[model samples]
Target: MLTNVAVLALDGGHAFELGVFCEIFGMDRSDDGLPPYDFALVSATGTLVSTRHGFRVEATHGLDRLEAADLIGVPASDPDVPQPPQLYEALRAAVARGARVLSICSGAFVLGEAGLLDGRRCTTHWRYAAELARRYPRTRVEPDHLYVDEDPVITGAGTAAGIDTCLHLVRKLQGSAVANDIARRMVTSPHRQGSQTQYVRRPDPGRRSGSLTPVLAWLDAHLHQPLTVDQMSRRAHMSPRTFARRFQQEVGTTPLQWLTGQRILLAQQYLENSEEPVTAIAVRTGFGSAETLRHHFFRRLGTTPHAYRRAFRADPAPPGR
Candidate 1:
């Protein structure tokens, strides 16, 4: 259903953010058994658009292209520039018809101009977060997140964070396997949790001292086992309370939440790449039973295990086979 994709070309756009959309959605991967999108770059006014880096790119289509787009990407542009009335109306109309729009970095300002960010939770580059909040007072701006997904409108933070936001839409619309395969091709993480904090300047407390890398690696290898905060604390040679505090500090989440996330990720892999039954996958991922797995899967992913497998399973055989 998300096959048609278009990117809006504006003057003084960031080339890297535009390229991120082109790379993720414009590439053809049908030979690799992945779906290829009907992708286009469209200009709101003319064909030749200038970039913030003092370069120019040409768009073959105009605003008419946006009408058919299931997902419209708005790359970073001059936030202070006034958007065309036609472009703003087209964006509102597209969203009105159930089409989704995504913005990268300062592109969130364009969405705000279109009145799409009103009363929605969004984010932009940290440097511009306060301005975005001040301009769109009704919207909740979370500057610390790598991205924010308010369903039909997703906003990414900074430059490279656009990659995370785009991959997340793929995982949401298609499935994890498709998103993961695309990410592997692009040499990036498929699904970085949206709650993960942005990189900030912090003093290093010496290399490899009091690090939790070994513990994390061990947990990765033992995802099939029932992991507990108490057990993990003992393995790390710390009290349970201390371990919980450290996990929140280092991982941005509590130990059990992180472990549940890991198990859910493992279950997603099995559902996509294997023919294992739901019960088998639940047990394999340490969910104890299929019912528990379904509860967590739906709670975390908003889809049941069977439904997710049907959408994402990679089997290539013909239906009758």
Candidate 2:
């Protein structure tokens, strides 16, 4: 039902965020059997909008175009600058009529100014989460989430997470089959749950002497085997306490937390690409038992393994079927 799409082209907006919408919704994918959307770039301030990247875009449509759009995309721009009052009013009207609005990165601030964020949970880039919460006291700001879908107002964190947010909406309205095909065309991950953490820590390359890359590579290869902090610490040539402390500093999360996340990702891949039973996948992914795998799957993904497989597993049917 979400066929019509409109992306706002604000003055000084970030180009990448705007392009995310264009890439996802504007492309003609009907040749591949994917649904095509009626897409347009709408300018709220004027016909010509300058991006923060020193490029200019001409938005042939104006705010009036929003009236026919089923989804409105707001890309990242300066949160401190004020948007036109009419822009805010048009957004409110669009949502009230049952259309959805999504914001990428700092675009959540524009929603806040329009009063759409009040009494709803939302998120933005981690760097702007605190300010979003401070500005809109009524809304709960979750900084760690990749995206928060509070119905008609979804908010994605940072730049790349915008892809996750848009794909999620597509999967929800269309079907996982369509979303998965689109993702394959884009050469990106098919699904990254909204609840997944946005923070992914990597050790600085300059600090090679203390890098945990070797230890992490070992863990990745040995996910099916039992692992303990003591074993990992020995692999890193450090005492257990020292290893834990250093990991927290460089990884932004505990070793066990990171290990669990990796295991879940592996389990997801098996579920999506194979017909393996849950019990088999459990042992293969280091969960030990199907019950244990279900526990973690529900805790982290908010869905059972069976349900996730049903949602994401590729259709056996050929294209155009």
Candidate 3:
């Protein structure tokens, strides 16, 4: 039912967020047995819009194109700048007519201006979460969530999270088959596990050639080894307590937590790009067994390794030399 898609562009937009919408919805994927969306970029202010990075984009369509759209997207824009009256009214009209609306990052602020975020659970980039909450007190802003789907209004957290939000909408409307196909074409994960909390950047640990750099590098190289705090401390020439404290100081997480995250990332690469069995991948990633791998996978990603492979497995490489 979500056939026609339109992205509303305003001045001072983030080009990357706009491109996320364009890449996911603007392409024709019928050759892959996927639905082709009738997509357009409609200028909310005028035909020419200035990007935040000092570039200009000429949107071929105007606000009139929004009337025919079944799903509307608002990419990241200047949150402090007030939205145009006509733009706000147009957004309200679309929602009132039963057309679903989505916002990526700061675009949620636009929805708030349009009065669509009141009493709604939403999210934005973690950096702007405080301002979004302060400006829209009635809205519950879950900063740690990658995306929040409150039915007619969907909000994505940050840049890459916008891709997750768009894929989710596709999965919801069509099915996993279509969404997975599109994700494969885009060369991204079909379904990413975990919240944005894991991605929030921590304060700089100060020293460039810190004491933990070598230890961290070693851990990355030897994820398959049975590593423990005692072993790590021995390598770093520190006591277990000192090593734990140093690890947290430099990495923003404990030794075990950092190792688990690394293993999971490696497992994800294998799931998407290789034909290796789940058990084999488990052993390679230091999970010892498929059961342990599945436990961690479910806890972190909300999906099994096999299911993730099935959804994200890439097309076989062309026969080569």
Q: Best-fitting candidate, measured by TM-score?
A: 3
TM-score of each model, paired residue for residue: 0.63, 0.65, 0.66
Candidate 3, residues 190-295, lDDT tens digits: the string is 8887677545543222433677887777777798989999999999999999999988897788989888878887888888888788899999999999999999
**Per-residue lDDT over 1-321 for candidate 2, one digit per residue giving the tens place of the 0 to 100 score:** 789999999999999999999999999999999999999999987889999999899999999999999999999999988999999999999999999999999999999999999999999988888799999999999887888899999999999899999999999999999999989999998786435341433333344444897888788889999999999999999999999999999877899998998888888888888878999999999999999999987887767888777667875435564
- Model 1 agreement with the true structure over 1-321: per-residue lDDT tens digits: 789999988898999999999999999999889999999999987989988888899999999888899999999998899878999999999999989999999999999999999999999998898899999999999887788899899999988889999998898989999999999998877865433231332222233234676787777778788888999998889999999898888877889888887788888788888888889998899998999998987776656878777766788346875
**What is the C-alpha local distance difference test score of candidate 1?**
0.86
In candidate 1, list every pair of residues with a backbone clash.
Answer: none
lDDT (Cα, 0-100) at 234 in candidate 1: 88
Query: What local lDDT does model 3 show for residue 55?
Result: 88
Candidates arranged by lDDT, highest first: 2, 3, 1
**Can you list the residue pairs that collide in candidate 2?**
none
TM-score for candidate 2: 0.65
RMSD of each: 10.8, 8.2, 7.0
Model 3 regions more than 4 Å off? 204-321
Clashing pairs in 3: none
Judged by whole-model lDDT over C-alpha atoms, candidate 2 comes out at 0.89
